[model samples]
Structures are given as structure tokens and as C-alpha cells.
Target chain A: MNGFKIIVLAKQVPDTRNVGKDAMKEDGTVNRAALPAIFNPEDLNALEQALRIKEAHPGSTLTILTMGPGRAADIIREALFRGADDGFLLTDRAFAGSDTLATSYALAKAIEKIGRPDLIVCGRQAIDGDTAQVGPQVAEKLGFPQITYAEEVNIEGDVVRVKRRLERGIEIVKASLPLLITVNGSAPECRPRNARMVMRYKKATTLTERQSANEDYLRMYTSHPYLNIEEIGFKDLDANIDDCGLAGSPTKVKKIENVVFQAKESMVMPATDHHLDALMKELIINHTLG
Target chain B: MNNIFVYCEVEGGVIADVSLELCTKGRKLADQLHCQLEAVVIGANLSGVEKQLYPYGVDVVNIADDPRLEPYTTLPHTSVMIQLIREEQPQIALMGATTIGRDLGPRVSSALHSGLTADCTSLEIGDHEDKKNEKVYKDLLYQIRPAFGGNIIATIVNPDCRPQMATVREGVMKKEILSKHYVGTVKNLEVSRYVNDSDFVVSVIERHMEKSKVNLKGSSIVITGGYGVGSREGFDQLFELASVIGAEVGASRAAVDAGFADHDRQIGQTGVTVRPKLYIAFGVSGQVQHVAGMQESSMIISVNNDPKAPINAIADYVIQGDVNDVVPKMIKYYKKNTK
Candidate 1:
């Protein structure tokens, strides 16, 4: 039972749950190729809870990391076609427009240059910044200990247990290891893609995607360096080009509006359910949940 | 020396209605920053929530309590909110985007380097700019929200942080309560040496409560669903029409990622924004992250067999139909018109 070095953190957003009419662009921005980036559905439910705590410990080791741009190495080769043994992209141009405190300070300095690990798991928000606030600001910038919406994590020996998902119910905590979790889209639904690990890590890539492939996919990712999915920019960590991204973000967006509430006159019913249960007891006896 | 704190959130001994709607929106940002609105209250027998947080216009209430600050453990509520924002330097703090303020507002805004703003639906005090020295920062807090998916309304502003934090969302603002008692002063925050006992490394091992406090974020009636309520026994007949109409079911992050409900019964821009008074969207085909979390529900009623469902133009009652044959005929016509 040895195995507990996970990492997860994935992102590559867009696919704003499929919005259209070219999902906004008259000055507000996000027309990110009319949506379709994927792999941020609660970071694939936090990479299936770090592949179920690396299949209940046993030489454990999941990985992933991401940051975005450099086409977020397509969510680090979709977390190595769902099993992840390697992944890290962090991308560059000084982390571009960060926010979420410079994306948790370039992911807590790329999890301290991808070193500290005993679990990190992510995804409590990132449907293009719904702001669950970067895994509790990357567990308060790596001083660790974060459990968040989690939904079943287990481990039990050096502590972990989790189960979170709360908005009024369900909670169970434990925490201890080099912790940090987030998960929840009601966690547990990330398993497909092991057609033999997709014909063995379907060309892993990300050396800027093997320098734009071709030439027999650059001699099979330079003779399979675990098919090379590692692209660390911001000078490979220790980052601090002003704390890494929109000059180390501190919130800021002043005005945007575009809201559309409107509907003040709506009385169209008739599919009958006794007039929708008598207008739900006449709006709960007129306290009008407003 | 301006103020306005409000992290109240007591939970089941009373206090969280989004911390009395962020103290009635921190008593109008503490009467537009003339100062004094406080309210802290960490846990452990959060003693008489200062008379239920002084008619919600507080004026100062603090109260850390103890027994290891009962229940909420985020290293003792982020070291008692980073030592109450560094010994009350609060210019504006606020929380209640629940789940213990999204896990204690970004660890007390990253241990007070400050700048939070998550889920906020509006806060305002105004004056922002400093987009790299375009300088402005006058009485800031703006914070606003709903971006890109609820399609715009951004606002945000931390203009060089200093407790100008935020969180909001829980029926976005308005829980009013100042009919009297703004005569504050309650204090009591010792917090045993800023927490120890290995910061109570996560404790509460069982609190299954979903038993009739039936609050889907203060539900007055909410039947949510979507992904065409197509399975998981169509959300157990939309929770048998939310228990024959006492109501509260909510979902849609495509029926909670197609497992058909339970990311704490999700309900929108990353779940839970509800304003229910009667929301009822079955087979819910309304997205704008589930209609920006129940578009201030005061009567929505959708149903959806897709008559071009965009929650039928902000539904006030648009039943086109088929939530597994209209939610068992609206739960057999509400148990035969309620006895």
C-alpha cells in the first residue's frame, strides 16, 4: 500500500456548458473560439478524485497540473487519456491574465516546482472563473490543508476522509497529509478512456505540443520520453515576473453590465398540474421568495 | 477608520441567511462608509448571536467563542479570519457564498494579502480604476459578478487590497433587519492563541442533516432539474414533486453531471444561487448556468418539452411539457388538491 503522490489541478475551460450565438464578443471578450475547450468539468471531477486516491494506494502517482494557453496541452493530453502518470503545462507569456490571485500564484509556484505531493486534486470552480477561488487560493498558497466541496476521498491512516459537497447537507472531514482537495460536480464520473490507455497515451505531446507535430510526429515524441507532456514556462518555476500573470492579479475589472433580467410580465401557464399546485400555494402564501 | 465586516454564518443555532444577508448588505456598506457595522461570530455556542446579530445592522459584534470554535475547521476559521483581518483593519470584509464562505473566503483572502470577490452579485461603494496606475480606489468594494456565462455584469475592484474582500451570493442581497438595535458593542474574541491542537485537523465526522430544514438555499419552493430530467428515475420523480410540494430539489449542471442530481442538489453558475418562492423548472432546459442560479425566483415555473426552452423567456409559468409525463401529473395533482 505505498502510493500517494497525486496532483490533478487541470483546467482548459471554455465549453461554457455549450452556449451559442457565438457566446459573447461585442467587447466583453470570451468568444474563445465559440467555445469548446472542455476538460474543466470540475477538472474531470478532480480527475476522478485523483483516480480514486490512485486506486487505493499501491505505488500511487497521478499528476496533471495545467495552467492554460499552449492550448493548455489539451488538458495535458486529457490527463494522459485518463490515468495520468505525467503532465504539467503551466504555459507562459508570463501567465497572461491570471486573477484568482494570479491563478494561485502560478499554482503555488507550480506546486513548488512539482515537488510537494501527497495529493492536491482541484476543481471547485473554473467554468471560466465561477471563482471557487482557485482551490482556496491554492490552499492559501501552499501552506496546504484545504478540503472544499470534495465528495468522497477516503485514505485513512495518515488521515484524509473528506466527502464535503455542502449547501445545507452532507459533510465529513478528516484532513492531514500534504492535503488540498476541491472536487464536486457531485464527484464520481470520470472513467472512460483506456482503450489500453488509449493505445498507450495517444501521443502524449506538449513540448509546445511536440513543436507542432509532423515528421512522423517528431520521431514519436523524441523516442517516447513518456511521450513528453511537460511544458514548464515562466522559466520553469520559482516564478516571479511580478508574481506571474496579469502582473500578479489583485481582482480589478471595473464595469461590464450586460445583464438581461427583463421578464416582469409572465403568466403563460396551462400544461396543468392543478395550475402548478395552485401557484405553489400562492407563492408560499405571498412571502414571494424574492 | 471605516468598517463593515459580517461573516456571521452560525448555522443551526441561527445566523446564516447569508449571514443575515451580509448584515443587510453590511448595513448599506456601513452607511456608505461612515463606518461601524462589524458582526464576526466564529462558532462554539455562538452565544445569542448578539440578539440575532442586532437587528442586522450590527455596529460591532465579534464573538469567537470556543470548544475549539465548534465545527467549522479551516485552521480555526482561517486563524480567526486572519486574526480578525489583522486586528480590525477591515474596510469591508463580508462572506456567505456559503460552504463556510467558499471555504473561508480564499483562506482569509490569502492570509490577508487580500482581494477576494467570489460569487458576489453586487456590493458596491464605488470608485475603481487603477488598472495599472490609472489610479482611483476611492471607497471601493464594488465586487459584482455573473460573468461570461450569465453573460456579463463584472464590476470587481480590490484596488490594492486591504480587507476589501467579498463573497455574497445567497439570494444575492436583501435580508434587511434594522427596525432598531444598531446600538452595538459585543467583542469577546480571544480565540485561544489563534488556534491549536493541530488546528483541529478536520473533525465533524457525521452531520447528515438534509432533514426538513428543507433549505435549497432558503427554498420556498424549487423543483429544478434539466438534462431533461431524463433519469435517475427522473430525479426520483423530481423528489416526488419535492415531497408533494413542500418543495426543494434543484439540479442542472446537466442534472448534476448526468448522475441526476446531488452536487448538493446543484443550481447554477457553479451551483447554489437560488432565490426560490416558487421556481419549478422540470426537464429544465434553461442555461445561463441554469438561469444564473434561479433568476431571483419569485415565480418562474418552466416545465419544458422544449418550446425553445431558454426557460421560456424567463418563465413566470411556461409549461410546454414532459418531465416524465409532467412530474407524475404534478405528483398526482398535488395529492388530489391537498386533502
Candidate 2:
């Protein structure tokens, strides 16, 4: 019932929505240069849940923690525009190509450095990987319980009640404090940026971004420390280099292939099902069901 | 080489559909690896259900029955599976990519210091070579899946880890019953003894059933929209067209991400995989992830302003017009025709 410290985990992903023909290279790897980077869709859903909890608990503080390149600081600014107190960008070359395991390890180290939080909210999965492993893995590494596919959450006494969306139906569950919950895309959609907050924090920059900024803006970020989003690297979290990125990942991608199903296997039909009776019977006979 | 183990999940006293699909795939993989195809079911009082395994190509079935395991919390299931895999040392283990499997697979694999590939669509037994490193790992579990939202396919291999694991989505493979052969064996286990009360950190307080208004799986005609639907009002036109064609309304991940529709109605990877007799897309440009789930529909019709949308490639009929402009016309024409 009291105010609690909350951390929201977000990611900056390629805007695959506007995928072009050249989205992938001959090697099957993503052509990062061609696509624009945007906030992961579900992570915005996660931040909305965190914002909801913060709204209910008046004095609660919500912080954004994301692990990506320095440009990932954009997500922090995005979060701040929607009412987050602070954020940290876990960036460094060492964190590249990290599978869920290594990604969780580095994130867990970052979480530990931030100290104990009453709740940790993350999206069910990132659009890029679609693994859904990092959330539970961080809970395992942190020795805290986790609730996945959470549709709704609320505070009751010291226990956080969560309604989980399972394949069959919904189940309401309860757990103690210091728990992690992965928000589903089914959760409430996030609010658009507030015009006032956007105008206020539009000048926010990280130390890395400041390197490319003009002198006047650098002086402004220094004068208003809040304008400088905190940036942490591998050394800051004390993460082992062996367990931070590609080196720590166990799974290896051996090959990539392009696939396009043949339309010739299917028949072209007009919008009107004028031959409805015949089509239905044919589908039934073919075991497509009546 | 060791046997391949498929963990069967039971719901409402019946085996899940994905489990049976696992048996079909496991049997093929087992034969390729020269080992037996084994299955393990964890639930309460699942005595007669072991009979269902042999018909699905399982040569051996193991049941860990416990009343506490009925609804399935994370720890009790993970404990039994970890113990079972350690004892059998199966070279490959598989589970469905359901809510339970996704939560449990990562924990189990991490605890065992192995690797897990989630949402794999294809599995094969073959050699994996790191072409860049010039190293070849022979006879590995070739775990193949859609990466970067199905734009590309990546075949992964956990060469050094024992018991390579994967969680496959339902309906990815057709399930078939193999005739009872060679009198299969069954073993009842007492795995509940290993689980403690502390293991269940989060307990179910209540259960609520929110059956969707439209069952996308059972509907014969499906009308799907994508981000191109634009807004919530745009999605209303989609429902109007669905009502005219007697089709269930569905959305692509794009629409769901755009907050124009609910998640359950989203048709694609991480959402429901639907194979209706007729699938119509309105203003929907199909992403690879969305196409992976709905490409099997009998008659696919795509409507979009852009002629080169990916969904257009797989569509049987392509209409190059904005969905907003076209859907209302379809509704008016259908209303004029015979009911």
C-alpha cells in the first residue's frame, strides 16, 4: 500500500514494421543500417504497467533500465517523457550479440548494482529475439520469483496480485515483494508522449551523446544533471567479460535461409464466396473441417 | 546417443495437442538418432492416460502423478523434469512453447548449464558447422526458427551441451497416431516428494475464464487486419466486414502493437496460429512473424495500397487499394448478395 521502487526493463529494436526487401543480408543477419531503431512494442506496454502502479502509489519511483548501444538512450528519454524518474543505459561493445542467458547475466548484475527494487517489470519478449527468456532468467539469477504473461497487476498489502494470461484462461496469483513480472502485449496500451514533458526533456542527453553535442547544450546538461541520462558500461556493473556477450552465449546459429511459400499451391478466389456450398464441402472433404 | 524425451502437458484431464505433435516429431528424431522415443506426463492421478502414449509412437511412458501437480506451478514440474533428465541423460528433450513450457524451459536449461531454443518450428538431426570458425559439430540437434520477426531463418545448435532442448509451438506439425507396436512400458514416479512448499513462491488465488467473443481457431472464415488499419475506428470497419462474411475478426501483430485490437485476436508468431478455410487481409502488410502463423489458409486474399507488401507474395488474390476504402465496399456488396 506504500510507495515502492520499481524498475522497468526496455529495449530498442529495429522497426521491423516497415521492413524492406533488403531487411536481411546474404548471411541471414539483420541489416541494421537499413532499418530505423524504435522502442520495442511490448516494452511500452511494460512501462505503461509500471506507470499505472506509480500512479496508484503516489510517491513511488519508476526507473528505466535497458541494455543496448548508446543509442538505446532514446528509450530512456522516451520513458522519461511518459513519467519515469530516472534511467540507466547498460551499453558497451562487450554486450553485443548476447543471447538471453548472457543478456540476463549482465542485466542481473546491473539490477544488483541498483540495489533492491520492490518490483521489476519487463515485456514478455523483445521483437528481435522473441525468446522470452531474459525475464525469467534474470529472476532465476536474482533468486526472486517471477510471473510471466501478466495481464494485470495491483498492490494488496505487501503482496502483489497478478492476473496471468495462460493458453486456457486467466489465473490470479499472489507473491511477496521484490518480484519480477513480464507484461504481455495484451496489457493496456501505453499513453502517448505528454507535450509538456517532451518539451522539458527534449534536450536530455547521455555522456556519449554529449560528445557529439554542441558546447551550449553540453553546458546545459551539466547545469541540469537530470538532463544527462546515466550511462553504465561493463566495468560499471562489474560483469565478467566472459559472461557478458557472444562469448558467454551457448547456442550458435549455423545457417540462415530465405523462405517464400509458393502461391501456386493455393487457388485464387474472389471476395464473394458465391460458390460457398461447394467450397465448404470441398474443405470438409479435405479434412480442413466443416 | 540417448533417447529423446518429450514432456507431455495435461490440461482438463486430457493431453495437450502440442504434446501429441511432439510425440510424432520425437519418434522421427529418435529413429534418426538410433534411440527410443520416450514420453513423460506430470499430473495428478493420470493412471489411464499412459495408454494414450503408445499410439503416438512412444515406446516408453513415465508418469509422475501428484495432486499438487494438477494445475501446474513452475517449481514442482521443473523439479521432476530436471530429475528425470539427469537420470535418463536423454540426448534431446522437447516441450511445447505454451505458457508453462516457456517459463519452465529456461529455468531448467539454465540450472543444467545447457541451452534452450524457444519457439522452434523445425527440428532435424544433422551436423552444424561454424563456417566462420571452420569448426564442424556432427550429429547435433538442428534447431531451426524464425529470427528478426520471421524475416530470416536461423538454425541453432547447442553442440557442447548435453540434452539439447527446444519448445515448439502448437499446430506446427501434424499429429498422427502410430499403431501400438512392441508392447510399450510405463513407469509411475513419485516426484512430489522432491518438491517442497517453499518451491511454490507464487500460488494461484483464483481462476477466471475469459473465452474470446470469436474463436479464431474454430471459425471457417477469418478477416485479419494489420497496422494499416490506422486506428481503433478503422478496426470497427473490419468487424463490420467480418459480420458480413460470417468470419471471425483477427488482427496481425502490427494492429495489436498499434493498440487497434486485443492481443488474443492477433494472428501470428507469439499469437494464435490460425488455418481457416478463407483468410482475408485488410490494409495488412504481412510481416514474416505474422505470416508464419496464418500462411496455411486455403484461400488467402490481401488488400493493401502498396503492391509489394510481403503478404501480397503469399496471397492468392491481391487487391491494390487502401483497406479503409475497400472494406466498406466489401460489406455493402456482401449485404446486397444472398445471405
Candidate 3:
């Protein structure tokens, strides 16, 4: 059977899961600069699914498509180290302040430019903005069907079967080729970086990154063409200027308030036998516990 | 022409609770805006489904009953919603943030270029003054949600979009019946006009939807653990304590992510929201997301090793200790005192 082309959408997000004391500033806003940037957790799961499909189908090529600042190339290199064939970094100043809709527009345009692959895979949502809209929005823009919360995906011939994780239960669905699937966090964890592949892709950098690199990397790019990660900006795609970033996004953040919970009067006690017994007695008397 | 619309989800002929909740909220919004409340239900064997929604102050019920529409597929549902919404031109559209709604809301929003927010914690009708544009939009649906890992609450608005679309989780809004005898008209849609045969590209093969055993939302007392609980085995003690007290067991998002608890038992902004009478948090350093779900509990007890765990701020009683030491002791003391 002939191999199919697959694309995996990914993002680089702040490590919000491990927010420390310093993660928030005095003004009650997130201190984003202090947080370490990492590949979005579920996006790694998506890359793993794409890699499996590529491995299962001979001659299949998997591409990673991500839209963010130039730093996002880090996740692409990370994907390469895990078995992806190549990657595209969609970075431009115009893409800033783009909500899910505008982001999907930019991504759909890039996918069209890359020649609509047979399959597209992405994480259900990004951690920075847990709005799981971009996947289905992109599918709508590309005029393809979508299966979300996918836990497992199996492909045979022209048909693909997907296992979806729902709130109450599970549903197995089948669709033909040329569709999109959003991987759930419940899916298998991505395999760790292979030492051999990491060494091969350690020098892979976008053109912007290559320009800032030292003289040795410039010489290495000439000898190894595959190490050059393709970069796409606003000018590269056929898109209307109004439909790019903030102009394209319909939803606007009217206001942002720092989350503050009202402090309640509390009796503080140490974990001792006496304090424990008294606390239990008080709860039972108050009809709070039995 | 400009009214409020709710996309009611039907499974085995019964309307979803979230849809009814939206209808309740939508009715209020419609009244505030002086518009009528309309509900759209698409499924097979949907006779008399409008009876469930009319009580929620729904003025119009749009039904597209088709055999193929029983189990929702993304394309057909999206097609029907987009066509119906375009014809109706509703000012606001709301849906449940369930698996079906999340999968369908974005597609419809993208098709119509309308703004859509997911898992909104609160929805209010408020006015927005665009200072930069010197424009004022009156009575807009303020979609309030916690973002950036629940560090901040953001209020979003769609000033230019036709239908300000938003999806709220099932338990986020309260469902109330306006009147048992409230009357509304039902408009049976011609399914062929709204959808095409090509829309049925994806088909459901197998399905197993079991009723959730843990009723966190319905329980009066809840015992929750966090990452500090350590491992899957550590959760066993929490279960023992829950069994002793007849409380439901819940977990923080961190605990669920750490594989110490099931995702269904997670109580946070992303998980289930519960307002039990008594909430006992063990080893939980409450992030805003976790607090968002249970801050309304009548009484809260926080047990954490850290004296200044964030959860302690809203807790009625703060016990400084380890979950391993505190849980077993609490269980023992409760048994002794109650007996």
C-alpha cells in the first residue's frame, strides 16, 4: 500500500502545571517570563500518534506544524528527536494576540500551503489557553471531519477507526482518510528522546535560529541540508491581512482579574491526637460529619 | 429575528441536563435583552421532547428528528446548526461543554466566523465600551472563564460576531423550570434541506456510555486528595476515610494528572464542579482551578503539610500535617466519636 502524508499540530507552552510561588506577580497576574517553556504535554501525545502511524505505514512521512514565536522551533526539534520526519515553524509578528479562530485560520492556510496532507493530528487543547477550539476550527476551515478526544487511532487502507474518550463513556468511530483527530491526554505517553535521533537532530534549527548561530552551525547546515527546519511567515501564505491575528480574532479579552478567594476565619491546629479528637467531635456536633 | 438559541442534546430521547440548564440561563438572558428563547433539538424519536424544554421558558423549539441523527456525528450536527442559526440569526447561542458540544461548537463557530468560548464558569449580560473604537455594545453576553491554568479570570466579548457563541460545563449553571404548563411552539425542520448525504462521512461503530458511579455533584460530604497523596496506593486510605464518613472521593487536577486518581473524580475548573455541604481537602494546595469547583461548599477543612497552603485561605479549619498521618487519624477519630 502506498504511504500517506500526515501532519501533527503542536505548541510550546509554559509549564503551568508546576506553577511555583514566583509564578504569580505582585499584581496578581501570571509571571509568564519566570515559567519554563516546554512542549505542550498533549501535543507530545499527538506526535507519538503520528509517529506510530508513520511507522505502521511504510514510506509515510510525518510533519510537525506549529504556530508560535521563533522559540516554538524547540518543540519541533523535540518532535524530530522522537521520530518525526520534518517540521515547519509558523512564526510572524502578525500572529500575535490571535485567539483560537485566528490561530486556526493561520494554521489552515499553512496546511493548504504544505499541500493538504491525508491526515492531521493535534492535541485537544493548549495549556496556555485551555480552549479546545483550534482543532475543530481548523478542520472546519479545511472542510474535513473531526474526531476529538481520541484515545486510540487505527488506520487500514482508506478507513480509520478512532476510540474517543467522553465524559461518561467511550465511543469508537470510523471515518475515511483525509480527516483530523485530536489526541486526548489519556492516550499513551510519548516515547522518550532516542539518543541516536537526538544526536542527529540536535543541530536542527530554523533559518532565524541559524542566522543567530555561531560560524560552526552555519557550516554544518551547508553539509547537512535536512537539519534546516522550514520557517513560514505571514508573507509566505495567501491570507488576507485582516484575517491574520488580532484583526481576525472575534473574541476580545474585555478584562482580566487576578483570581482572589475571600479568606475565611479559620481555627488553625496541629496534627495531634488531642486536636484531631476535638476537631472530629466538633464536626460531628455541627452535623458536618458522621 | 434576533433571539437567544440553545442547541439541546438528546440521547435515547431524553434531553441533556446541560441543555436544559442553558435554556434556563438563556431564558433570563433573552428576557434581559427583550428577545425570545428558542431551543433546537436534533435526534430521532424526539416526540414530546419540547415538553421538557418549555418549562425552562423556551418560547420556540426547533426539532430535526431523523433516524440517522440519533447518535450525533460532527458534520451532520454542524451542518444543521449552521443552517438553522443563519436562518434564525440569534444574538446569542449556548451549548453544553460536553464531548459532543466541544466537538461541534468550534466547527459551527468557525463556519459562521462567530466567537466561541469553552468551559465558561460564568455568563452574565453586561455592557462593553470599546474605548479605542469609541463604540458601546449593550447587553452583551459576558463569557467569564479562568484561563492560564486558572491563574486569572478573563471576561471575553464578541463585539462584531453575529452570534456570540459559548459553551458551559454541565454543572456550571443552575437549571430551573419557569412553569410546568409553560407553552411553546415546535417547528419541525426538513432534515434534507439542512444536511446532505456527504455529511455522514464518519459513522459510529461501537458505543458504551455507562452512568458515572461516583456522584460528586450529588454528595453532601466530599473527601478530596491532591498530589501530596503520593501514589495510587495512597488513594486507598482516602477511600477508607470516605467510606467511613459516607462521603464521595474527589481529586485535584494535579492528583488526577499524576495518575493517583481517575479523571472523572477530579474536582476543578476543568473537571466536575461540586458544592457539597462539607468539603475535606487532604494534601491539597488549592490552585484557583481546584478552588473554583468547591469554594461554595458550606464548610471546608484543609489538611496539608504546608501551614500556608492556598486552600487554607478559604478553609474553615486548617490542620497542618501530612495526608498519611492526618487521614488515618481523622478516620480513627471520626469512627470513635460517631460510635
List candidate 3 stretches off by more than 4 Å: A214-216
Ranking by DockQ: 3, 2, 1
lDDT digits (tens) for residues B138-166 of candidate 1: 77778777776565668888777688888
Q: Each model's TM-score, in the order given?
A: 0.33, 0.86, 0.98
Give the winner by lDDT: 3
lDDT of each: 0.77, 0.83, 0.93
> What's the C-alpha lDDT at position B154 in model 2?
80
Ranking by TM-score: 3, 2, 1
After aligning candidate 2 to the native by TM-score, how far in Å is the CA of A280 from where it should be? 12
Each candidate's DockQ: 0.23, 0.39, 0.85
Q: Which lDDT tens digits does candidate 3 get at residues B1-339?
A: 889999999999999998998999998899899999999999999999999899999999999999999799999999999999999999999999988899999999999999999889889999999999999999999999998888788999999997999999888788899999999999999999999999999999999999999899999999999998999888999999999999999999889988899989999888988889999999898988888899989999999999978999999999998889998898889989988
Comparing to the true complex, what docking class would candidate 1 get?
Answer: acceptable
Task: Compose the digit string of candidate 3's lDDT tens values, residues A6-31.
Answer: 99999999988888889989988789
User: Root-mean-square deviation of each candidate, in angstroms?
Assistant: 21.7, 4.2, 1.3
Of candidate 1 chain B, the 10-residue stretch with the lowest lDDT total is B330-339
Ranked by lDDT, the better of candidates 2 and 3 is 3
Better of 1 and 2 by DockQ: 2
